[model samples]
Target chain A: MTKLFIPLDSFAVACGADTIAEEFKRLVADRKLSIEIVRNGSRGMAWLEPMIEVETPDGRIAYGPIEPGEAETLVDAGVLSGAGHEKRIGKVEEHPFFRAQTRHTFKRCGITDPLSLDDYKAHGGLKGLERAIGIGAETVIAEVTDSGLRGRGGAGFPTGIKWKTVAEAKGARKYIVANADEGDSGTFADRMIMEGDPYCLIEGMAIAGVATGATKGYIYLRSEYPVAIDVMREAISRAHQAGVLGASVLGSAHVFDIEVRVGAGAYVCGEETSLLDSLEGKRGQVRFKPPLPAIQGLFGMPTVINNVITLASTPEILSAGAAAYKDMGMGRSRGTIPIQLGGNVRHGGLFEAPFGMTLGEIVNEIGGGTASGRPVRAVQVGGPLGAYFPVSLFDTPFDYEAFAAKDGLIGHAGIVVFDDTVDMMAQAKFAFEFCAIESCGKCTPCRVGAVRGYETVKKIIDGEHPAENLVLVEDLCNTMKFGSLCALGGFTPYPVMSAIRHFPEDFHGEPMRVAAE
Target chain B: MVFQARYDEAEAAEIIGEHRHLEGPLLPILHGIQERFGHVSEEAVRQVAAALNLTRAEVHGVVTFYHDFRKAPAGRHVLKVCRAEACQAAGGDAIAGAIETALGVKFGETTPDGQVTLEAVYCLGLCATAPSAMLDRRIVGRLSEAKIGALVEEARL
Candidate 1:
C-alpha cells in the first residue's frame, strides 16, 4: 500500500491543510485505494504547505500548497503513483530551499508522525535522555558544557552553566521550565517544535531534569498557540504512558515529569521571571534580579529555564556527543540556529544553519528577495525588540556577538523582510506602541517611558519640533535601555533608534506617510 | 445571537473543583469557567477567589492583566485579526480597515446583531505566511480582502 503525508503543523492548517486532508481522505476512501494517509509535521517550506508526499519506489515525491478542492484533480492525474502534476515540487529534501543547510534540531519535525513514540525513536529521538541517564548527571552536564550550547531563547546564555547552577543549588526540589511563550511576531520555531516534534522537547527536558536533578518540568506555552497547547498536553500524557516520563523516567531511578501550563496572553511572561509568576497563578510581572531564576526560581526552588529550541537542541547534543555539535559553528556562537524568515520574502520559512551566514545571503539569496518583487528596504532580524538593518548592513553575520556589536540582537532568530514602500517612522512609533501595550507595568521606565516614547514619535511624525522630538526620542530610548527591568523595555530602543539612525530620511522628510494607507 | 446563561454559583464551584488540585490552579480554573460559561463573570471571579483562598483583588488583578480572559460574553463568533508587525508588513492594515468597514465595527467591538466580535491579536506565529487571523479555533493565514470577507460571512452564520 502507498502512503501519503500531510502536515498537521499550525502553519499548514492555517493555510487549509485540514480541508485538503479531508478531501484526500474522501477521495482515497471513495476509490477504496490501498493507500495510507499520514499526518506529519510541516517540511518548513510554508509557501508549499498543505504539501503532501507520496511513497514511491525511489523516494517520497512532494506536491503542494494544494487548494481545498485540488485533491481530486491530483488523484485523477495518478498522484498515488507519484505521477507528474503541476503542483509537484519533486522530492522535498532535494528542493534547493531544504537541501542547502543543516537540520539537527528540526531533523525529525517534518518527517515523523508527530505523536508516534515509535516514529520518534526511529528518528533518534530519546537517545539524548538515554545517554544522559547512562552517563549520569555530572557527565551529562559536562557534555552540554563542552558542546558550547547557548540558550536559543534570544538571551544566548550558556545552557550548561545554567544547568550547573541549578544542579548545585540547595533546594529540596528543582524545576525545568520551557518558555514556549513565543510572542515574537516573526518567530514560530517554538510553536513548530511543540506541534511537530513534541517528543524532542520532552526528551530534552527529561535530560535537563536528569542532568540538573530537577524532578518536575513545566512548559509555559502561550494561549495564542492553541494547537501547540493541545498537542503538547497530549504528548506529555503519551510520554507518561510510554514510560518516557513519570516517577522513573524510562524505568530508571531518576524521577522526572512534565506538565503543560498555558499562559493567559501576557507577552512579558516570556521573560523567565514573569513566566514563573504566571505559572504560580499571579499577575505576569517581571521580577527584579539578584536572585536569578536558576538560584531561586518557581516557588523559590532552583530552576532551569530555557527556550523550546534550547531544550529541543539537547537530545541531539547528548546523542551525537559534544564535539559533534561543537565543531559546527564559528566564534562564540556554536551549533545551528533555526532562522525564521517571514514578512515580504517570496520564500518565507524556517532556515536552520550554523552561525556566520551573512544577512544579505539569508534575505536576498536564500529568501529569493521580496514577495512583492520590489526593492528590499529593511530586514528586521529578531523579534519585536530587534533592530532593523538596512540593505547596506546586509553583510552583517547572523551571530549573537556580531549582532550585539552592531547594536542589534539575533532575538529568537526571526528575520522579517520589508520592501522599500514601508514607512520607517511609523515602524518606529509601533516599536513604542508595542512596548506600551505589552509592558508588564512592573518598572517605571518601561511603563511610563514607553507612553512618552510613543507620543514623542507621533510628534516627530506630525512635524512638531522634529529636531527636538527626535532628540527626546533618543533620550527616552537611552533611559529605557539602561533602566528597564527586562528585554521588553530594554530592547525597545533597538527598533526605535535603529529606525532613526538608518532611515534618517524618513524621520526628516516631507509630512510622514501614514502607515495604514 | 448565542445564548449563554448567566453564571451560576454552584456550576462555577464545580468547575473550580476540577482544576483546584493542580499546582497554581487559578489560571486553569479561570480557563475552565470561561470555557464553560463563555466568559469569566464577576460572580465566577468571586467564586474562584474564595475557592483558591485568595482575595478578589488578587484574582481580579490577574484577570485584568492578561488579555485572553474576557469579562463578559462575546458575540456568537469571535474573529481575531493579526495587527502585529509581520502581518502589517503583508498589507494587514488594508485588510483590517476593509474588514472593519464590512463589519461596521472596529477592533474590540461586537456587531449590532451579536453575529461577530472583532479583535486585534499581536501575532499568531504564522509569519511565514504573513497576515493571519483566527476565527474562534480555526486559524487562517495569507489573509486577503476576499478571505476576510468570507471569514466574516462564516462568523455571521
Candidate 2:
C-alpha cells in the first residue's frame, strides 16, 4: 500500500494539521482506501505545513498548506495516486526551498519516521557514533577540531576547544548539557531537531560523553515546546532500551545516559550559566565567569554545555570526515548553517545553507520578499539581541565575523523581516522593555539600566528634548553594553543602537515638543 | 479583581514526592505543584521547602522568578497572544487591541467572571504562520479578528 504522510509537528499542528490529518484519515477509512497514513515531522517549509506527501512510484509527491476543509477536495482529486491538483507542489525534493538547502544536520528530519530506530539507522543515523567509537575519544575531538566547527549557539565558540577543556578539567564527574531553551523569537531550529529527529541529538550527546568521559547528559528544554519535550523524553527512553544510551552505548564500554529537564518560563536561562543554575533547581540567574562552564559548571563540576544545533551537528562532523565538512563553507564559518527566515517574510522557513549567502539573496530571492507584499524596510538577523539591518546592508554575507565587523551578529541565523509600515523607534523601545522584563536582576546595569533606557526611548519618541534624550539613550546603552554581566544586557544595544542610527526618522515627531512650543 | 485559591499541603506533598527522586528535583517538583494546583501558593511553597529541606524564601524566589509559574489560579481559559516582532509584522498588534476591546480587559487581566485570562507571550515559534495565539494548551495560528472572536466564544464554553 502507498504511504500517505501528514506532519504532527507543533508548527503543523498550530496550522490545524492534526485536524486535517484526522479528517484525511477518516475520509480514507470511509472510502476504504488502501493507503497507509503516516504522521511525520514538518519539512521545515512551514509556509506549506500540513504538507501531505505520498510515496509514489517516482518519489514522494508533495501537496500542502492543506486545511481540514480541504479533505474532500483532496479525495476527489485522487491525491493518493499522485494526480494533478491545485495544491500539488510536485516532488518533495524538487521544491526550490528543499532543493536549495545543503541539509546535513536536517537530512533525516522530514524523511524518516521520527520514532523508528530502524528508519533512523537506515538513513545514516548512528554512523557517527559507530565511527567515533571505533576511532576512540581523542580522534573524535581531533576530527571536530580539524573540521573547525564553531558553536552554532550564537556565540560561535569552537566546539573542539570546549570539549577539550572539559576533558582536561580535573573533575571526577563531568556533564554534557544541551541548551534547548530556544527563547529566540525568530528561531526554532532546536525545537525542530528535537521533534523531527530526536535520535540524532541523543547520538550526538552520547558521542560527547565518549569524547569528554562525561557519563551523564541533560537536555534543558524550554517549557514552551511541549511537543519537543515529549518527543525527546520518548526518544531518550527508547535510546536507553535499544542500548543506544545507558551503560554501554551501542554495545561499547562507554556508559552514557541522558535526561530531559524542562525549564520554567525564563529566557535568560538560555544562557549557558543561567541554564546550569536552572538545572540545579535555582533561579535562572547569570553567574560570573572565569570559572567558565568548561572548568566549573553544573554543581561546580566541569561541564560541556553546548546549544542544540551544536550537539545535533556533531554526528555529521564525526561520520563525514572533518575535511569533507570543512570544504563546504567560506572563511571561518566552515559547514552549513540553518538560517531561519521569519516575521513578515513571504516564504518563512528554515533554510540550511553554507556560509557566504548574502542577506539580500536570502531575504529577496529565497524568501520571496515580504509576506504582506509590501516594500521590505528592515530585517533583524539573529534573535532579539541582534541588530536590525536596513536594505543598504543586505549585501552582508551570512558569516559570524562578517556580521560582527558590521556591528551586527549572525546570532543563531534567525532573520525576522519588517515591512515599510514598521516603526523602528518602537522596535528599539521594545528591546529595552524586553530586557527589563526578562532580566535576571543579578546585575545593576541590566536590571536598572534597561528600565532607564525604556524611559529614555519613550521620551525620544515623545520628542521631549529629542536631541538630549537621544544622547541619554546612547549613554545608557553604552553603560548596559559595557557593565552588563551577560549577553542579555550586552546585546540589547544591537537592536536599540541600530534602530536609532539607521532609522532616525521614526524617533521624530513629538507632540509634547509641539505643545511646549 | 485578583483571584486567589487556597493551597493544600497534602496535595503539595504528593506532588513533591512524585518528583523528589530526580537528580535536581526542585524544578520538577515546582512544575508538578503548579500544574496540579493551578499556581504555587504560599502554603505550597512552605510545604515544598519543608519537603526539599530548603527555605521558603528560596522556593518563593524560584516561583516568582519564572514568568510561567502563576501565583494564583488563572481563569478557566488562558489566552496567550504573541506580541513578538514576527506576530507584530502580521498585524498582531491590531489583533491584540481588538482582543482587549472584545474581552473588555487588557493583557494579564482575567475577565470579571473568571472565564478567560489574556496574557502576552513573546513568541510561540510559529513565525512562519504568523499572528498565532495559544488558548489553554492548544496553538491557534494565522488568526484574524473573526477567528479570534470565534476562539474566544468557544473558549468561554
CA lDDT scores, all candidates in order = 0.91, 0.89
Best by TM-score: 1
Question: What are the per-residue Cα lDDT tens digits for candidate 1 across A325-397?
Answer: 9998889999999999998889999888999899999999989999899989998878899999999999899
lDDT, candidate 2, equals 0.89
The pairs that clash in candidate 1 are none
Scored by DockQ, the top model is 1
Q: Distance (Å) between predicted and true CA of A289, model 1?
A: 0.6
- What C-alpha lDDT, on a 0 to 100 scale, does residue A306 get in candidate 1? 99
Q: Which stretches of candidate 1 lie over 4 Å from their true place?
A: A510-517, B1-3
